[model samples]
Target: KIETIDVTPLNNEQSIQASLKAFAQFNRDPYQDPGTVMRHPGLLFLSEIGEVKQQVEHINALKDELVTRMHTLNARARNTHVKMAWRGVSALQLYRHITAVDYAPRKALFSWEGRTTSISRPHSKEEFIEIILKTKDMCPAHVSPLDWDDILRKEILYIQSVQENGDLVRMKPVAPHPRLLLYKTTDVKATDTIFSNVPTFVKTAPDCTIVELTSFDFSKTTTRRKKRVFIPIVERLNMYFRPFK
Candidate 1:
């Protein structure tokens, strides 16, 4: 079972302090009031922004052994290159709630090629989001979805708490799932995701602060046809370059 790490008692290393200083400098907004920034709809996210390397290193320092263990597990399972998906800091203020929903590949949940599945009928992304939202209402705020028999019969969902300072929630790499976090007290949090076997290119900006990935990838089974196999990757790369143009 995965458990949250309590970093409150741990002393910050020199490198961590330096990284935090740089991060604060880069993310500082002169126009916004410091008092109200957390209340804004667009909360500052720590990932994919300034200094990807620095951010990853910061997270590693926070939980070095756990990060190494994840890399080892991914290598054993996927036998492919491992990459940092994203890493960042989150400030969860008191009484703030975050909700997460499980994400499955659409092909897994919806019927395809007229082959009906037990999960549900074919639906678009919008419809799927609607279904998930409805499910969120089915349970009380404090109850975890794992306890809901009806939801469990069809899908898996759960709620976990990370209320204290230095509490780290670790999730294994399995399927892409969303999360909901409720902060009972003000807490500064760090989170990261590492992925393997994802076919895409990551390029940092000229300043070496921001990292962006080509959005397209092979989500389907490979075919013997050369054109079909390679065209999508070419197109995806082309798409990634469009911003430069």
Candidate 2:
């Protein structure tokens, strides 16, 4: 890993600016992919005008390994699930993993460790297991429109969360379904085709930090063989990675 960066030095405007500045470091159209939206950090994000005030700690011990995995995606952005929280701070910390070309997902997760409080959005229970299970390789599953009942619930709760918690942190998902687009995607579900609570974090990643990891190719290959695991599919779309790892 290059090094653990303490980006806490940023506040609202600066944080927003940092996001855009970081965009300056990369050049790629994140939206060419059918579902992904071109980010407008310049317009969507606020400009920097403040100093650093709070800082959050790195909880993921394997942060370095995570960075290595990012080598595939180019400069991309995502919503994260993690938060650098304080006893009563209104603003939360967000982690935006980048892949020199695209953003990584799940690599950036949300974690809150403090009091035991919870938020909930009300909606009919969804057939979540069925819908989630339908994503099998090569095999397609059908979902009933009624099945979306709970998804809307989750989204409603997600929004309620942004209001109640006053902060958000999370990573974006790679799934192409519009229902799953929360990051830099133009297709925001029109008027609650599905409603969700405003998630605290961007589920998508702008870039990944894993490429900077020390070389361990033999180990990585072994890892793939042993676990039958592969890099995230989204990585293929990213162009920042070296032609060959």
Candidate 3:
């Protein structure tokens, strides 16, 4: 039988630090009965006990300093308009960063119909925003808005993405040569959705790489239908990957 505990509320860096401190204190002054210690002379070694207590005291001092620094950081982190998101192997990784709760890892939370493929590695902050703007693809209905706001405000700070067959990357401009992914099928239909609905290539192709399509039907489709859309294939589809090179 498998049991799952929801630790989303309890997970966080500060909480984990507190737990460690408590564990250290327990080890330093272990609760063994006096009678038991008397029976086993080796258990009551004064020098060893003193050393453990000294180490525990040192840890406590460090923790006190850490608390002060954390308070200062918390103060500075307030009212920040900029936000970031990370794409990793699982949402648990993202959640852990957000909440600081220690729990068993779960499957990727940002998925559709329990089916997911080809995680995105956007090339810039705008690209990341665009990815999240796709309400149908990424939004979690079960999570409360307040919880999400807190998570976004506190936990997420950098945008990490996956690209080129799971190579860990971020949405930032890099020097040398830029890398990107393209659509596998040149025959992308007008009816197809962006990113999620359409299939993308695993490898990054060249710039201005146009995919010539045969006669396509666009009649009957009125709203949100583009007569002609230029999908960037060689580089990132966002401003960062725009053909300025």
Reference-based lDDT, residue 175, model 2: 19
Off by over 4 Å in 1: 1-20, 23-70, 73-147, 156-245
Q: TM-score for every candidate vs. truth? A: 0.15, 0.17, 0.17
Better of 1 and 2 by lDDT: 1
For model 2, the superposed segments whose C-alpha errors exceed 4 Å read 1-140, 161-163, 172-245
The sequence of per-residue lDDT tens digits that candidate 3 reaches over residues 26-61 is 111245321111010000112124444555456547
Worst 10 residues of 2 by lDDT: 236-245
User: Model 2 has how many clashing residue pairs?
Assistant: 58
Superposed Cα deviation of residue 15, candidate 3 (Å): 26
Clashing pairs in 3: 11-99, 11-100, 11-101, 12-100, 12-101
User: lDDT of each model, Cα atoms only?
Assistant: 0.27, 0.26, 0.28
C-alpha lDDT of residue 212 in model 1: 26
Model 3 segments beyond 4 Å from truth?
1-47, 75-138, 141-245
Candidate 1 collision pairs: 46-88, 51-209, 98-180, 98-181, 99-179, 99-180, 100-179, 100-180
Residue 176 shift from truth in candidate 1, angstroms:
20
